[model samples]
Target chain A: GESVGLHLPTLSVQEGDNSIINCAYSNSASDYFIWYKQESGKGPQFIIDIRSNMDKRQGQRVTVLLNKTVKHLSLQIAATQPGDSAVYFCAETFPGNQFYFGTGTSLTVIP
Target chain B: EAGVAQSPRYKIIEKRQSVAFWCNPISGHATLYWYQQILGQGPKLLIQFQNNGVVDDSQLPKDRFSAERLKGVDSTLKIQPAKLEDSAVYLCASSLFGRSYNEQFFGPGTRLTVL
Candidate 1:
């Protein structure tokens, strides 16, 4: 079955440094991708999103890079903060507005 | 603007018991979604509603799970004769429209523990 997967299950980063999380999706037909942050005991929060036609999109202190050829996506956060500690998930949208999510990458920001 | 809202933040029930979760999407949002997220994993879409009409439910465990969105505003997800594996966080999300390009706003979620 086609699925989205993360390269690393856990990541630890020093505060004030940059952090990167990677994801690989198997579906070639997917046209939209999103990154979400889920804090403990909370639902996933929308972070950033990129369209297949665009290779990169940037937001406040965050960037999403999409590589259609390899079906790879990456999320980059600058000046990592303790509040950034959480599980991050990458999702691909299929037809009918259905989304498929990867397992997740747990990010821990050390102060 | 107010975000999505869900009720009964936490629930604990023995296997075979029934449980129900509720959600109210953002005002005037025409699309609603329900997802199940187990610990250490990402959320899995269970069902989707477009203005009180079901659009997709292929991933839903029809034998034990059911959902309804009455009046195209509030929705409920029900699980009957639950199993231990059913334990997970039920998340509700909504978007302005049912399109791949629309961003979905999520609720806090309901944590369900089935013993």
Candidate 2:
């Protein structure tokens, strides 16, 4: 079955540095992608999203880069803070309303 | 505005027991979704409802899992004869129009532990 997957399961970065998380998806029919941040004991919070038609999209300190040709997506965060520590997931939506989520990457910002 | 709401932040039940979780989506949102999140993994969609009608439930374990949105406002998910693998956090989310491009607002989630 087609799925979305992350290259790394855990990442540790120093505060004030930049962080990047990578995701690879198999379904080419997917037209929309979203990045979500989930904190401890909380639900996923929307961070940013990019449409297939666009190559990149930016929101605040977060940027989402989409590579349709390679079916790869990346999320970059600048000036990483301790609050940024959490699990991040990348989700893809195809023709149907259903969304497929990646395994997720846990980002830890060390102070 | 209030975010998505769920009840009983945590639950502990033995295997083969029955359990139910409730969710109330954001006001005026027409699309409701239920997802299961196992530790160390992302949330997986269990079922989706569009204004009181089911739009998708392909991943839901129909044999033991059932969900319904009676008035298109609040919903409930039930699991009968729960298995150990069924122990996980259940999250409810909602979007404005049930559109593919719309953003989904999620709740805090209900954590279930099956002994």
Candidate 3:
């Protein structure tokens, strides 16, 4: 079955440094992708999203790069902070609004 | 605005037991979704409802899992004769409309432990 996957299960970065999380999806028909942040004991919170038509989208201090040709997605956080410590997941949406999520990547920001 | 709401933050039940979880989506949202997230894994969509009508339930375990979004507002997910693999966090999410580009707001989730 087609699925979404992450490149790394965990990552560690010094506070104030930048961080990048990578994800790969198998479904080429997917039209939309999103990045979510989940703190311990909480549900995922939307961070940013991009459509297949676009190659990049940016939010406050965060950027989502989509490589439709390779079916790859990446999230970049500038000047990572302690609050950025959480698990990040990438999701792809099919035509009917059904979303498929990847095995999350845990990001640890050290002070 | 309030985010998605769910009940009974945690539950522990033995295998073969029955359990139910509830969710209240953001007001006026017409699309509701139920997802199962196992520890160390991402959330997997189990079902989706569009204004009280099921739009997709392909991944739902129909033999033991069922859901309904009565009145297109609050929804419930029930699992009968639960199995150990059913132990996971059930998350409820909603979007303004059932569109692939719309953002989905998620709830805190209900954690279930099947003993």
Candidate 4:
């Protein structure tokens, strides 16, 4: 059985502060992970992705860290803005399989 | 490049009423997907298609849900006698192919309200 879940259902951070959202997966066989951000009334948009081989990956304003030993993944948003407030989801996928998405964490940026 | 397109940005109907949603993938995309997302939750895959062929539909509620991609380009998802629990956003996504490593671009989802 494979399960992905977030540590927190909601997170609030001050504008311009850093935000870290955590996720856990039960499938050790999972080799790839992706982060998606969905705004109100819109479908999810891709944020960043990390392969099992890499422990950390960085994008423009986001960073994904993978801890294979702990079966945990985390996404860090730098200088969070009002527009960055959205529901974030972490999805895991093994080779030759569809991705399994976590419940998701709502991020609220307080100005 | 144009992204995936879905129709009926919003739909409201009473329980037991049948409703259908449509999706048109990006031109040349060989793979398409339909997902159901309840409020405050992530999208749950209902079906996947690889050029008009069913790839994965293990989570789809076959008893009440049906979907088709007749031409390998456009798709339709229908819910028969919808339930109150069926209220959610139906999302469509597409990729170049059913590659496990490629990103699937998503479209504006259709909000379904089954009262």
Candidate RMSDs in order: 0.9, 0.8, 0.8, 1.0
- Per-residue accuracy of model 3 over A1-111 as CA lDDT, tens digit each: 559999999999999999999999999999999999999999999999999999999999999999988999999999999999999999998786588899999999999
How does model 4 score by TM-score? 0.97
Scanning candidate 3 chain A in windows of ten residues, the lowest lDDT window is A91-100
Candidate with more favorable, higher DockQ: 2 or 3: 3
- Model 1 - which docking category? high
Give fnat of each prediction, in order. 0.91, 0.86, 0.95, 0.73
Q: Residue by residue across B1-115, what tens digits does model 3's lDDT show? A: 9999999899999999999999999999999999999999999989999999999899999999999999999999999989999999999999999988899999999999999
lDDT for each residue of candidate 2 in A10-106, tens digit (9 for 90 to 100): 9999999999999999999999999999999999999999999999999999999999999999999999999999999999997675888999999
Q: List the residue pairs that clash in candidate 4.
A: none
- Pairs clashing within candidate 3: none
Please, what are the lDDT tens digits per residue for candidate 1 over residues A1-111? 559999999999999999999999999999999999999988899999998989999999999999999999999999999999999999998656589999999999999
How close is chain B to the truth by TM-score, in each candidate? 0.99, 0.98, 0.99, 0.98
DockQ of candidate 2 against the true complex: 0.85
Q: Is the docking of candidate 4 incorrect, acceptable, medium or high quality?
A: medium
Error of 4 at A100 (Å): 0.9
On residues A1-111, what C-alpha lDDT tens digit does candidate 4 reach at each position? 369999999999999999999999999999999999998888889999999999999999899999999999999999999999999999999887888899999999999
Go through the candidates in order and give each one's DockQ: 0.83, 0.85, 0.87, 0.80
Whole-model Cα lDDT per candidate?
0.95, 0.95, 0.96, 0.94
- The regions of model 4 sitting more than 4 angstroms off are none
Using lDDT as the measure, name the better of candidate 1 and candidate 3.
3
Ranked candidates (lDDT, high to low):
3, 2, 1, 4
lDDT of 1 by residue, B1-115 (tens): 9999999999999999999999999999999999999988889999999999999999999999999999999999999989999999999999999988899999999999999
